[model samples]
Target: MSSDLQGDGGPDRPHAQTEGPAPGAAPTPPARRRRNSYRSLTSRLLSADAWVDTALWRAGRTIGEGMRSYDRFLRRFEVRGFSRAAAELGSDGATFGLLGLLVLLTFAQPAFEATRNADWMTTEDFAVTFLDRFGKEVGRRGIVLNDTVPLEEIPDVLVKATLATEDRRFFEHFGIDIFGTSRAMVENLRARTVVQGGSSLTQQLAKNLFLSNERTLERKVKEAFLALWLEANLSKRQILKLYLDRAYMGGGVFGVTAASEFYFRKNVRELSLAESAMLAGLYKAPTKYAPHINLPAARARANEVLTNMVQSGFMTEGQVIGARRNPAIAVDRSQDQAPDFFLDWAFDEVKKLSRRNPALARDRIVTVRTTLDPALQRQAEQSVDSVLTEFGQARRTREAALVAMVPDGSVRAMVGGRDYGKSQFNRAVDALRQPGSSFKPFVYITAFLNGYSLASVVPDAPVSIGNWSPRNYSRGYAGPITLKEALTRSINTVPVRLSIAVGRPAIIATAYKMGITHELQNTVSLPLGASDVSVIDMTASYAAFANGGLKATPYAILEVRNSAGQILYDRSRNEPEPERILPADKVGELNDILINAVENGTGRRAMVDGVAVAGKTGTTSAYRDAWFVGYTGNFVSAVWFGNDDFSPTDRVTGGTLPALAWQKLMAYAHAGIELTPMPGVDPARLKPAQVARTGDGTPAATQPRILSTRTAEVLGRIGRSLDALGQTASAGEGVAQP
Candidate 1:
């Protein structure tokens, strides 16, 4: 190529060296020509280096000129121009930050959806105040205070203690404290467990208001977003107020005011520093630190709160020293051992009644006048405790339940277990146990409904149905015994025979109509009390006989009124009247038989002096359960003794501890109460040792054995027919229920 075309024609350029051939010359040997071409290329590259330097110098001059022009242009405004540019840049950055924040909020739609509940806008859905039948305040349930205490009204020490222990940086952050969270995370990582929570007070309020106690990532995300939403909407004061007002304090209490009143028996405004510290300590776990349950633990927790206040610079050690020296002591409630079990049941009833009435539900606060009798409740609790304390170890039983009600089905007292603190299982209302011979009344009532009188004869012999045979408790048959006598002895085979004779369905129908709510299975041993039933249900069923053959449905709440004195539910005004379930004569006959059972037979231990008692005893197979359900003219009560695991005791018959407990409870219940005659019961029969006499001036042996010879023959034929029918039934039915 020519130098002129290559633009390599400079006068100061060095001459190109040639090894063999020159430009445009004929090619020499191929290798010699190639070497010559490489040398020429090297000569041109060395020449281009100088040209490249000149070009770079020219470009540098051009850039210098442009920079000088820019400097001259900038010199017009001087320093002010730089400041304005920086301000504009900062403004742009702020706009981008706002947009980024909006984008982050967009990801919180799920949290917004989770926390949105219209009901939460208000303080509470409902608060319940419980009163006894006499309109005296025995105890309280639900949110006790209808109105939340203002933050200004709360003690300064309480607020300080709460902030110190719960969230020290409560006022320093917006919903989520990043610094606090990071510190907590590091600490948790070092410890390998979550010993400290990083949630702010606002976050805690959000969780309390809208979330459940769940430790899940999804729940945490929702809690965070809701906390942010709360911070955005509410001031710090409002958030703190809500946190204090909605947090759960123990003893079925919510909010500082209720907790103060519950533990110290005073208004929140009157709380001392020590009491305030105790209440503040319950924020982490209310049940764990409830003063009424465990005073020492509560005091220890309060001491921690006081120390936290000192460390947080809210108080000096001297200021908290008094609380440490003598911790707050709760009022002695020894006289008022509140029947918590009955109250719980009554609270549930209030909820149900409120749900049924939309207006009541909207009221959100009510005073329930329940059928509970405080004195009777105390007596019941004492009776159960005494029995379990005296005989529980010897009998190998750990639990006992007692339920007592008026003849009108008003539940006066209920003792769920020996100790309410150890367990909360309400055996009186929730547990179902086999009724044993106590269920025989339904079978005998069926016989009466079918035109068979108590004087009718029935052979109490060993009875067989398929592979199953029911024998008497003594394992010996009492041949040709009157129905009344059979029931008095609690003969199992006779009731089974009666059940088969009267049809098992009829017996079940009778039980249901009489107030047994449990679904009874139609089995061969059904009349022998194979079905499991609650003590409350059995008591209510027996109340029917006391209520003159009318179905006495069990009821706890007598009246419910709102805070504004408007009646929401009145049982007498709202509930339908009970219908007559059994004829008067049949009820009378059945009552006569049960009277004899309690007065002269197995249930004699349940007898109370100067009161007409009628009831039956029930002992389940292997002594797994023992029950005595008895009633005086004015009250009906049922007592049960058993183990929670369904383990058999050391042969505790119903006539033993259960009957004695029933007697104690009845004696207390019948005191100071006018005795009313039980429906179809002779008032004289209630007196001790006052029984009908037979010929020769002796007590009647088995109700005079009143069945005629012809009646006996008819009954014998009927018994045979029942045996055949029971065998057929057993083939179709399954084995008996335990």
Candidate 2:
């Protein structure tokens, strides 16, 4: 266009192109030039220098004009476009749209999954109900409610009980409890949590049926909206019924009706006051108040529920006491006799599985079938209670633990403490106590495994190893005794010498290989029960002896499955062969010696009337702990008696209480079952008659022949020696235990 605009006309530009049009000069007319002459045009066109100069001048002018336009556009027009767009997008309306987008995403996921609920709860992961090994419903995973009760079908007491506990102002509030939620907001702000939900029944139904259970402000806000939607659509009775049908109870149980049938093994129509109170209390923390896991806590929760019921004018105080008069139906020996202890262990395993999988069918419910014998569990509890009540009165000790397992090492029964109501600590699995002479079997087993003869005699003399000197419980040593006799009599000096001869490391290996997992001190006293171990370990180790010397791992869970019937875990599937720790021949020999201990030595109190018994007694220093670990061909069990505080008792030797407790448990456990002899030890080789029990309750030896005069003289001399040593040396106190 203009020459000044196209070219650098300022003073700073001295080398402007001379090829361009001259400033302020008119160009030649093309028509007149073309008409001048073909000859002149041809000559001018034919000159290559003239053509190149004309093209260069036009290209320079075109580029200069384009640069000026781009420079003007970048700073003036495009910058303003971006600023205007940002202002519009950052406005409140735009923010609202973004929030709406997030809400759609959050709700859309749950809504999409819900539309496909044509399948049963079984189709959900880990949502199917689990049954016991017998195929009876034990518990459920997920929201599996088989019996969907109507509002009319629900008991009045149950409705009031639930309303009193979960949401007292349910009928009063619209959807959300305004006052309650406001209070929860203030408290949560202080604690920084979704701690106190303070949700109404409708709100709970909304969250349970259609929510991710994610604890975030976005989820909470969505939950509030859904609750309001539920309130607007459904009646109050419909919402309450839905909540009752969808609530998650402990033991993977769901719904009021299913929980009624699961815990009480009865229909909702037949529920007792006590059962109703219990079901209502399960809302807050189902696992914590599960009657089987912790009866006392469950009872306490039920008591609170009953109190709520009374305060709400639903029931009287008299009715509350009467309802609680009978223990819940689950643990009633006359009714269910549930394996509460084993259930606790199995539930713990399910929890471990839940941790590995974040989305475990909401509330982490998974069907787990366990190996538990209800009959043996009952017998064990009775035996422990009877013994503690009778014998423990003097010791003033309130703690005891026991575990019983089959020859295959599947745990059948476990009692963590004397009374589960008083404590929840599982001593059988968790508590570590000195095993005392109960551990001697491992030392002798080490020797036996290494080719030491059971009949070989070891010198029983005063022993002083390093700075440690150990005296016989009763004065005067046996001088020389066979290994069988040494073990049968439980002599301290004998096992100490045997353990040292075999080497402590070998003993430790045998202990570990036999299933003793507790850390063992590498000192000389390792053989004398100086190391502490749980009753479960002792019982599991003894299973090797019962099952013909195979190393067995104690397990309670036998099968785990998801809702789709997929085998998530199976103990017997693709099972590996167990390790053979001791030869069957060696096991029989050990059995023979242990049987003799029960029949003739300190374990006499453990002898049963018709069955052959094999066991060992243990008493730690200062009577801090006592133990009896033993086994039949079919079962192995360990019992411990002591105070939780680790205080000395009234010298409650293992032989005195633990052995007696073992006898009581085995007597009932063996009833109606065919007795079998130990492997490799024929029953035909024993005496003609079974051992007898005197009126004083002391077991009579099977060997009927009277004591020989020579034996009597030897015992008489030993008595004199003991007398000379002073009464501090008790006559009946075994060498190892006392």
Which lDDT tens digits does candidate 1 get at residues 355-433? 6777777787788877877777887888788888988899898899989988788888999988665566799999999
lDDT of 2 by residue, 583-638 (tens): 88888888888888888888987877677778899999999998999887667899
Candidate 2 residue spans exceeding 4 A from truth:
1-133, 137-336, 349-366, 564-570, 686-738
Q: In lDDT terms, which candidate is top?
A: 1
- Which one is best on TM-score? 1
Count clashing pairs, candidate 1.
Answer: 1
Cα error, residue 49 of model 1, in Å, equals: 68
The local lDDT score (0 to 100) that residue 377 gets in candidate 1 is: 84
